[model samples]
Target chain A: MISYMLCLVLFSVGLYCILRKRNVIKIIIGIGIMEYAANLFFVLLGYRTHGRSPIYAIDQEIKSMVDPLTQSVVLTGIVLGLSVTLLLVAIAIRIYERYGTFDITKITKLKG
Target chain B: MEISFIAIPLASAFVVAMIANLDERIQDCIACLAALATLTLSLFAITVLSGAGSSGAIVYKVGGWVPPFGVSIVIDGLAAFMLVTVNLIALAALFYSTGYMKKYTDKWKFYALFLLLLAGINGVLVSGDVFNLYIFMEIAAIAAYALVAFGTTAEELEASFKYAVMGTVASCFIFLGIAFLYGYSSTLNMADMASVLASKGPSGALLLASVLFLMGFGLKAALAPFHAWLAYAHSSAPAPVSAMLSGVVIKVLGMYAIARIFFNVFGITPVISFMILTLAVLSMIVGSMLAFVQSDIKRMLAYSTVSQIGYVALGLGVGTPLAIFGALFHLFNHSLFKSLLFLNSGSIERVAGTRDMGKIAGILDKAPLTAYTGLVGALSICGVPPLGGFWSKFIIILACIQAGRPILALTAVVVSILTLAYYFKSYTPVLFGNVTTSKQIKAKSLFTMNAPMVALTVLVALAAFILIPVVGNVFMDGAVASLVRGISYTDVVFEALK
Candidate 1:
């Protein structure tokens, strides 16, 4: 339960970084941190102390097996995370080329 | 057979990419054919749905394994309606692009990405698995980002970047919500998850998941609070692409997904319904009021899309049979007229060489066809009498009244008047008044551009003609039945799987 609350805190911190940070790269990193917190919380949902893998062998009893679905879900989620990160990096590079800066504060020609 | 709706477009996108080295003409032709094929298949999906009466759901298991173990595509009424709306606009947009996209350099890449986006939308609509929907949504999102940046101008690139950042954040929330749902249900198949949710009842965790999804999909839909990105993104894209984005992409990725998840998967409670209604009213009022201040035609249309979607949301929020019908019908009507209006704006932009409504005066004398279609589209969208928008708005208002929400109904009426005022403010300047600049560039896209606009105009007009008891059943009532049935979805899925 403490860990769940910690995950929420991590998410809030990431949000703060995004809201307060002026650098585009920092904002991207904040997004990444938030995603990691969500992924960690998802994995924690299926965790139990001393729980083994949720797999069955012909010779062994399958009692107290840990939920494995979150593992697969998180794996896919990590791939999604990678793509978003790459996109953000690409956007950051483009911003640098176009405006000659990484500061989002200066990237303000698109008003109204 | 149902899977073919997605497979056809997916295969065509790859084919377009592989043969992109061929001539640009061939690439454009292939894109148009692919879009036309998708439209035909979507119509077929609608036919299949109408014929397959009361039969739970049609599951097309990819590798022939039963769901809960294998990924499947669920073809039902909601899927059919969404497929029709997306593919119809896709067809028209591709046709319009045949001429307009000549301004851009790499024609093949544009077509390939467009088809890929179509595939993503179709996949999102039909997939039974929650994770698969997210993947398909990302595919569409990435393709849209690329398309928005296709012009490579400073403004286009900046808008695309902003959109990408915000869209990625929305996807993160969606993924997290899906993870929570999976954790709660232990299954990724939406129907299977619904069964588990039905058994367990709504928990704090599930409610949290719902809220996350609402926030995520609301961003995607450009609902009131999360709509800042839309005005920029839609305005930055080329006109036809903007049309497709405003007309279909947001609905499929945002509104359709929200409706499917909340109504079918989790079931709508009074609290959730009330929350949706509040968002709807906020979006309608704010989006319209903001639109009234925009001088750029496309930007104004983008805000109007936000406002019209508010009507769909309001209808869905009512959670009654008539209300759902009105919402879905308004959704259908909005897609048709809005896409047509955007295409008209694109045509005007093509001729006038600018998107500012003030500069493009008295175009009616020079471009009669586009002017006619623009007027029809504008009036229809603003809920003028004997047009498509009126019936749906009338039904939505009636549903609000029936549901004992007179204030919501009154708000709908005020927004309708506001919608009319803004649209006319755009229309009268562009279509009537004095012939401003006589730039004699031969406009050569009558078949590819005007034909689709005219066809959609007819469909919008037909909506009014058939709003009576006879034709209303298949068009509106069927959609309402699909939504109002709600979590009876689990039973339908189990029965269909058997």
Candidate 2:
């Protein structure tokens, strides 16, 4: 329960970075942090107190195993997160080229 | 054949990307043909479902895996209905982009992203598992963010950055929600999870998961309070991308997910309905008012999308069969007319080289096709009496009244009127005035651009009659029945598997 609370606290910190940061790169990092928090929570959900690795071998006997499904889901989530991060970074680079600033406030060409 | 809905688009996107060395025109044909193929399959799905009756669905288990353990592609009334809407708009956007994309240097890249976007949308609509749904949602969302910044202009990049950041946060919320649900039910299959959730009754974890999903999907759909990113994103992207984004992305990823999960998976509680109703009311009033104040043409349309989504949410919030039917019908109509309107704006921007409604005066003579078709789109979106939009808003309000929510019904009616006011005020300067300014409209309205507008105009006019029993049987009723079935959806999928 405490670990779950820790995961959510990390998630909240990322949300704060997204909401409060002015630099585009910092916000992208925040996005990465948020994704990892969710990934960590998924890991926690599948964990057993003394769980063995979820692997199969004809020669070995297993008493208990962690949920393999959440591990696989986390792996997929990480790849997706990488794609998002790379795209965000690429867009940030292009933004710097156009506006010549990292500050989001100065990037006001799209305002109402 | 169920696999064809996804495979064809995926193959076409791959083909488009691989042939980057070839002439750009080839990729355009590839994208259109891919869209046409899925549309044919979508039509086929409808025919098959209409005959199979209520419990009938097309269930395709990936790699020959069974329902609960593998990624199952299930096409039911709801999925089929959404498929048709998505593919239809996708086809139009592909055709429009052929002409519209010439202004940009690289055409092949645009077709690649566009087809991938279609593939992602189709994947979302067809997948029966929450995990698959998340994967596809990311695919579509990522494609959309990249396409929005395709111009590489400062404004487009700014909008894309903001949209991407907010979208990432929303997705994380959704991902965490999925984790919570997984922990509670120990299954990612939506139908199976629905059964588990039903058997478990209400719990604290379920409550948290639902609230997290509400925030995630609501932000994607751009509900009133979470709608800061939409105006800039819509106004900044190229027009066809704008059309696709506004037309179906929000509906499939946001509204459709909300309806499917809340109604089917989680089973809507009084608390859930109350929360949805609150959001609906706020979205309707705020979106329309904000839209009315916007000077940019696409931004105005974007805000109106927020308002229109409110109507759909209101119907879902009411949670009666009639209201869900109204909501689905309105969703279909909005996709058509909104895409038409966005396409029209693209054409206007292409010819006049500007999107400022105040400046592009009296374009009827300069671009007759855009002016006339845009008028149809404008009227349709405004919910004019004979057009499709009117029927949807009327039904939603009627449902609210029947559900004994007079205040909500009144809100829907007033918001509909507000919709008319904004469309009227904005289009007056755009369509009615004479071209007296020095801006020489340099571009000619081409056949590629005008064709989609005309096609969509005819569709917009005819979309109103779709709710009639004869047509609705094939198109709308299946969608409503599937949702009405709710938790029994698991039985339907299991039955189809056998």
Candidate 3:
């Protein structure tokens, strides 16, 4: 229970960073943090107290096992997160190249 | 057979990327052929599903495993309808890109990403598993983020960064929602999950998941409050990308997901319906109000997209048979006109070298093809009589009244008028006026670009004819019937799986 609460707290903190940060790199980091937190929450959901690994052995009977589906799904999520983060970082580098600043406040060429 | 929708595009994207350097012309041909093939397959799927005595859906279990244990691809009435709309626009956009992308340095990369995006969309439309949907959504979203920044200009990079960040956040929320659903139901297959959810009833976790999905997909769709990133992202990308993004991406990823989950999986309750109604009304009013003040043509169209989407959402919110029919019809019509409008904007930008309506004039006199097509699109979007947009909007309003929501009906009428007012205000100066600037108009429009625009314009002009009873009962009714069946959708999928 406490672990789930911690995950929520971490997610909230990441959301705060994304919303409050003015630096482009910081915002990207914030997105990464939020993604990790979500992935962590998903992994935690599959946990079973005292449960063994989900892998099967031909010789033994297994009474309890942790859910491996969420683990695999979370792995995919992490990979997607990595790609998104890399893209964001690449765009940040280009933005710096073009605008000469990482501060989002300074990049105001587009507006309504 | 259904896997062909995804396989063709995935194969083409891979081939285009690997062999792009070897032969440029070959890559273009491959891309067009892939799009055409997908379009043909989608048409075939529609006919097969809609045939009399057919079961109304096709379920292909991956690896031949049964559902609730393995991922499945299910193509039903709704999926087929959306598939046709998506592939049709994709074909047009791919053809247009062949010519339009010549100005850009790397045409192959654009075709590659475009095909990947098409694959992602098709996968989303057909996937019968919740996690599979999210994975495909990510594929499409990532490709879109890269395409938005393809220009590498400061504004493009900035917009792409902002779009990528927000899109990632939305995806995380969707992922979390899927996690909650999986935890609650212990199943990933949508039909099985729906059955589990129905038996157990709605719990706090289920409600929380619903909220998370609302936030996530709502942002993707750019619905009202979550719509800030749309104008920038849509306007900054090259026009073909913009057309795809505006025409098909949001509808497929956002609205289709919303309708599929809320109606099929969760089974829309009165409270959920009310929430959808409120969001729809807010988006309708706010999106149009914001659009009325924009000077940039593409930005205006972006906001207009937000407003038009509100109408579709309203149809879903009403949740009546007629309303869903109107919604699905509008969804189809919007894709036609919106893609046409974006393509027109692209051609105008190519010729005039600017997107600002205030700086350019006399396009009708100079480029009659682009001007007329754009006018058809603009008028169709404004819900003018004898056009596609009019019949859909009229049906939605009528549905609102029939559903005992006269006030909402009145609001729809008012929003329709506001839609016309703003489109006329912004498009008139560019389409017909004195040649204000000395920007020389290119005498000839590229045939490739002009061809797609003309094709879409013809479709737009004839779109209203779909309302003819024979066609409406055949094409639109099937989609409407599926959604109106609501939670019974699980039974349909299970039956098809058998």
For all predicted structures, in order, the TM-scores are 0.96, 0.98, 0.99
Considering the two chains of model 2, state its CAPRI-style docking category.
high
Supply DockQ values for each candidate: 0.55, 0.92, 0.88
In model 3, the runs with Cα more than 4 Å from the true position are none
Candidate 3 residue-wise lDDT, B93-197, digit = tens? 999998898888888889889999999999999999999999999999999999999989988998898899889989989998998999899999999998999
With candidate 3 superimposed using the best TM-score fit, by how many Å does residue B425's alpha carbon deviate from the native?
1.1
DockQ of 2: 0.92
List candidate 1 stretches off by more than 4 Å: B52-56, B437-446, B465-471
Residue pairs clashing in model 1 are none
Clashing pairs in 2: B362-B433
What is candidate 2's lDDT per residue for B1-498, written digit by digit as tens? 887877898888888889989987788888899999899889988888998454568899999999798889999889999999999999999999998888898788888888888888898889999999999999999999999999988889999998998898889989999998999999999989989989999999999999999999999999889989999898899999999999999999999999889988988899999999999999999999999988888999999999999999999999899999999999999999999999999988887888887778887878888999999988988888999998998999999999999999999989988998989999978887878758678799889999999999999999977967799888888899999988888889998898
Instruction: Give the candidate order by descending DockQ.
Output: 2, 3, 1
Error of 2 at B263 (Å): 0.9
Tens-digit lDDT track of model 1 for B259-316 = 9999999999888888788889999999999999998888899999999999999999
**In model 3 chain A, where is the ten-residue run with the lowest total lDDT?**
A48-57
* Global Cα RMSD, each model: 1.9, 1.2, 1.1
User: Which is the winner by DockQ between candidate 1 and candidate 3?
Assistant: 3
Candidate 1 has what TM-score? Answer: 0.96
Top-scoring candidate (DockQ) = 2
